[model samples]
Structures are given as structure tokens and as C-alpha cells.
Target: MKKTILAAMMFLLVIVPALSEETITVKGSDTMVILAQRWAEKYMQAHKDVVIQVTGGGSGTGISALINGTTDICNASRPMKPSERDKLKARYGSRGVEIKAAMDGLSVYVNESSPVTELSLQQLKGIYTGKITNWSEVGGPNARIILYGRENNSGTYVYFKDNVLEGEDYVSSMQSLPGTAAVVNAVARDKNGIGYGGAAYGKGIRELKMKKDAASPAYPPTLENIRSGDYPVSRFLYLYVRNRPTGTLKEYIDWVLGDDGQKVVTEVGYFPIR
Candidate 1:
């Protein structure tokens, strides 16, 4: 009888821990993937019973996952479109909840070898619209310009199109890469290439200082500039949920908006919303 009791005790010990553990799945926004992973790593370290899984496909992909009930949290580099919110309202009877988690500057990346340093919004529009195909047009060398950009499914892609391109179509010759990292890699390898992505991934590349127009002073995507609204392309990063969080989910979300989570944001190379 003592042996039987010991066996039962052992089984209970194993089963209890398994039952106590909780999992949260985070999906979307390649731009925010590194930041999300860091948040998860730190949060899980402090809370031993919680597990977090993070993945990045793109913000659009993440929102779709949220609508389909596949992800617990959706990270987005841009605000959700009205259509997406409408769909969520129709399906779940909730407009969903949006939490601004961090800030980022949409940086334009160029090869380190490139001589060009700054671009006005007009010049950028011309370059992306295929009207300015030569580097010399933008104060660079007399060579053909190569453009790299994110795929249509990415939130960054939509944001860029709406803001930078003014709703115009991207030039057909531009190469659409899968993620910001890939765009950065492509520009790093090609001396004449230029791409745009989140500022966090600007390592080993030159980020162009941006001017709102010819009359305005150019501003680099520094923390001060982004936070102060001096940077022309600064935007907020977001976390979205299908409904008002409850229980463990509420606690986790609250924790994420607190100081510790914002600290993780700054450490991961993005500006904290707080």
C-alpha cells in the first residue's frame, strides 16, 4: 500500500506541472519578430509556468491568423485597415483590441559603398515610380539604380505604398523580397541596390536621411527624431487581440505594456511607446 501511494504521488507531481503550464502563440510582422522574441524570452524566464511561441510571416498574415483563431496575439507594424477590422467584427462581434507596443522608423537602406546620403519625398516617389532609374538622378554614381522592397502581403509594404508612393503602383522592375532582413541582405550585397525596411535591421547598411520635401531639413531615423516626429516615416508598432483579454491573457498583456516589456523594446532596437 505504501508503494502504491508513492507511485500515485510521482504521477501527480508530473501531471500537476503539465496541467499548470500555459502557452501563448504570437504571430506576424517580420519587422517586429526580433522584438517579440526578446519579449517572450524575458517574460518566460520570469514566469516559469508560461510558454510563448513567436513567428513572423508578415502583418497581413498575422491578422489573418488572428481572424482564423490560430494566433493568440498579432504583431503589426501598421494600423489594421478598416476592411480587416470589419471582417473581425462580422466574424467575432468584436472590433478587436489594438495596443500600441512600440515605435519604428521605416528606414531606407542603401549599400555602404553608395555615395548618396539623403532623399526628399519627391525624389523617393520618382525613384520608386520608375521615373528616376539612374543613380545620378539622386546625386549618386552614373549607374542604373536597383530597387528592392517587401512583398504585398507585408504591412510595411502597404504602409510604404500609402505614404511614400501616395497610393501609386510600385514600379514593375522592383524586386519584392519576403521580409525586411532579405531586403537588407540584398542591398548589402549589391552596391547599387536600395531597399526599405524597419530601422532595426539596418545593420551593415546605410540608412538614408529623409527630407519631407526640398525645403525641409533631412532627418536620420534616430530615437530622438522618431519620438519627436522629426523623422518623416516614423510609425507605431502594435499588438492586436480578438477580444478583451481575461485571466492569464490579461495579465500577460498588462505585463507587456509595463516597464519591463518596454525595456525589452528599447533593447531590441525599437523605440518604446512609453
Candidate 2:
């Protein structure tokens, strides 16, 4: 009986370690959810033993998950806040790690039928803040300008608010949607509607060319324009890890930053970090 028990224990020990290779969990940023999932799928094809899971709530949710130790990685479209960094130091004894994975122009979307082909930054701010409530105010048909935006938890929302709104509040009438894709869908069907999100999400909707001011030339959110810093709203997309990544996590991140991973970024309609 003792010999049999020892043999069973030995077998269990050997099998458990082999089966327990960590499954990486990536969470956060609805904007980056599609991109992250694509990367995970392609990476998993090459690495049979590894498992990866991706989820999107928002950048804030992902950062919270990182602080609480619930996710292996957090994808964000914006930089971490100072308060968030402090929380990471308190919980993980580190300031957390940020990896820039891609670039985004943070494009503004308008319905294809809208006559307004371009807007200055101040005009965008005025439109979003309710100061310019009519499409006619910006060279469009005389109609109420319906606004669509992301939820407050979204990094895109914060970035837009900080940079475009200039710290002013969004008009109370603006409808806050759950994701960038949702914003695009809403704008695509509404002639007077306008929205803003990652450039990758502007498929059915038309991307509005933006100028620094009335005197400057309006530029589309093309890769060339973004790379040249002509697109004023361009920002980096990021991946966050609790500490210096190690083991399979490190390997996966390395793969993501490599040539093939960046190719996926371009295929997904976002600019690769390279």
C-alpha cells in the first residue's frame, strides 16, 4: 500500500507541473481589444502549449485589473495617470511597465453625407462642448449636430477631453457609447452625426481632415500624416505589465514587438510602433 501511494504521488507531481504552464490573461482598452486578440491568436498558433485570453472593458478597468493582480497584461490607448502609478507602487512595489505597441491618429468620424470635410481643432472643441450646436456653423447643412462619444472610462474619452475639450465638460446632450466601433456605427447612419475614435475604427464613416487652425492646411489621418506629426491628435497605444515581464509573458511581448506582430498592427488598420 505504501509503495502504491508513493508511485501515485510521484506521477501526480510530474503531470501537474507540465499541465500548469501559466495562461496569460490580457484585459483592458476596448480600442485595443481587436488588435490584442489578433496578436494572441497568431502568437498561439506558433506556440501550442501557451494559452492567452483577451478582454475589453476600458483602459481604466485594465489598469485596475493590473493594480489588483487580476490580469497578466493591460492594453491601453493612453498613458497611465500619476495617481495610477502611485497605486501600482503601493501594490506591486514597482511603478509598473509601459510598452508602446502602436500609434493612432484618434480620428474624427462624420457621416459620409455630411458636407463638412474638415475642422480646425478649435472648431472640434466648440462642436463637442455645445458651443457650436449646428452643422451649419461648421459649413454643413443647417441641422442639429448630434454628438457621439465613448464612455468616461475609456482612455480615448480622456485623451479627447484633455486635448480637444481642453478640460471643458462634454455637452450634456452628447450620447456616450460603449465602444469606438459603436460610435462609428452611430455616425455612419446619422447624416448630422459626428464622433471620434481610433483611426482604425473609421471604416463605414468618413474620417474628417483636421487642421491646427483656420490658417493651416487640413490633413487626413493617414499614416504619413500621423508619422509626420501633422495629425494633431495622434497618440501611442500601450501595453502594461505589473513588473518586468518574465517567462512566457516576456517571450510573448517580445513576439508582439517583433516584425510579424507589427505587421498585424498595420493589417488591423493601426500604425505599428516600429
Candidate 3:
């Protein structure tokens, strides 16, 4: 009987520690996925007792998860919409907390071999809105211009539509990919292809210098340019929670907004909030 009790006690000791371990769920923003993953990895390394699960289904999806109590953190490339906040307030009686975790310059990408190197915001609007269909229209080869972009559910897509296109619709022919990496990959392979995404995923492709208008000097999405507001399409990357976080959740958020977390942001090719 004593041997049986000793074995049960040993089992409880192991199981209790496992149960005591804390888990954090982070979801949203395909544009922020790599950054979020890097943050999770570094945080987890220091906090062996905490587990962070990160996923990306776009910012809208992540916000929905937060509303439904499915995620502890939602990484958003754009601000939460008014309707979303209303829903959260209705469901949780809290207006959700927003944290500006990093900054990004929304980058326009093209094939490496393309001749076009810069575009005015107006020109970008025309090209994406189906008003300009050929590369020749933008000083490139005579080939047809192929557009690649993210799906409607993406915060990137929403931001581009509102700010770049000025609420105009994307051309029906635009290929809607799942994530920013996919958009970058699509542009890299097609010589006449063009796409937009976070600056971090600009590998193997040419990122165009952006002008606010034809008269403005074009600027690349460099850290200095973005920080100085010279980059035309710079935006904040956010982390949203359903409430004012406390306990382990708050600790993780505090760390993310700290110097070490901002260092990770720069290392991952984004500008720090600070």
C-alpha cells in the first residue's frame, strides 16, 4: 500500500508541474508572422516555463480569434476597425488593448530583371486599379503587367486599398496569394509581375522606391526613411489583446515592448516602436 501511494505521489509531482506551465497563443498578420515567431523563440528560450504558439491567418482572422477568446495576442499590421472594437466590447465588456510593437514600410516588389525602379503613389493606384494594364505604361517592357497581392482578409490588402488605391478596388486580374512571402515569390518569378508586402520579405525581388506624388523624391523602405516618415507607406505593426493584460500575459507584453524585444525587431528587419 505504501509503494502504491509513493508511485501515485511521483506521478502527481510530474503532472502538476506540467499543468502549471503557462501557454500563450499569438495569432494574426501574415506580414508579422516571421517577426512574431522570432519574438516567441527568444522569449521562450529565456522562459522555459512558458509556451507561445504563433499562427498567421491574416490580421482580420487574428482579431476574430481574440474576440472569440481563442488567442492571447493578435498581431495586426493595421489598426482594428471600429466594428471589431464594438464586437469585442459587446462580448467581453472591454475595448481591447492595442500595443504598437513595431513599424513597417509597405514595400512594392518587382522581378529583379524589371527595368522599373520607382513609382509615384498615383501611378501605383492606376496600375492596381486596372487603369494601367501594361508594363510599358510604367516605363518597363512591353509585356503585360501581372499583379500579385494578398487576399481581402489581409490587413496589408486593406491598407493598400484604402491608402494606395484611395478606396478603389484591386483589379480583378490580380492574383491573391495567402501571405506576404507568397506575394514576394510570385513577383520574383514573373518578369512583369508586381506585388506589395512588408519590407522584410523583399528578398530575391526588386523593391521600388515610392513617391507620394510625381513631384516628391522617391524613397526606398529603408529604416531611416521609414523612421523619418520619408517612406510613403510606413505603418505601425500592432499586438492586440482582449483586455488589459496581467500575470504572465502582461509580462510577455512588457518584454516585447522592452529594449530586448525591440532589438529582435531590428534583427528581424523591422523598425522598433521605440
Question: Which candidate number maximizes TM-score?
Answer: 1
Candidate 1, residues 170-270, lDDT tens digits: the string is 99999999989999999999999999999889999999999999999999999999988888998999999999988778888888899999998888888
In candidate 2 the C-alpha lDDT for residue 76 amounts to: 96
Q: What 10-residue stretch in candidate 3 is worst by lDDT?
A: 11-20
**Per-residue alpha-carbon lDDT of candidate 2 for residues 69-99, written as tens digits (9 for 90 to 100):** 9999999999999999999999989999999
Residue pairs whose backbone atoms clash in candidate 1: none
Regarding lDDT, does 2 or 3 come out ahead?
3
Better of 1 and 2 by lDDT: 2
TM-score of 2: 0.93
Clashing pairs in 2: none
Scored by lDDT, the top model is 3
Rank by TM-score, highest first.
Answer: 1, 3, 2
Off by over 4 Å in 1: 1-3
Query: Poorest 10 consecutive residues of model 2 by lDDT?
Result: 13-22
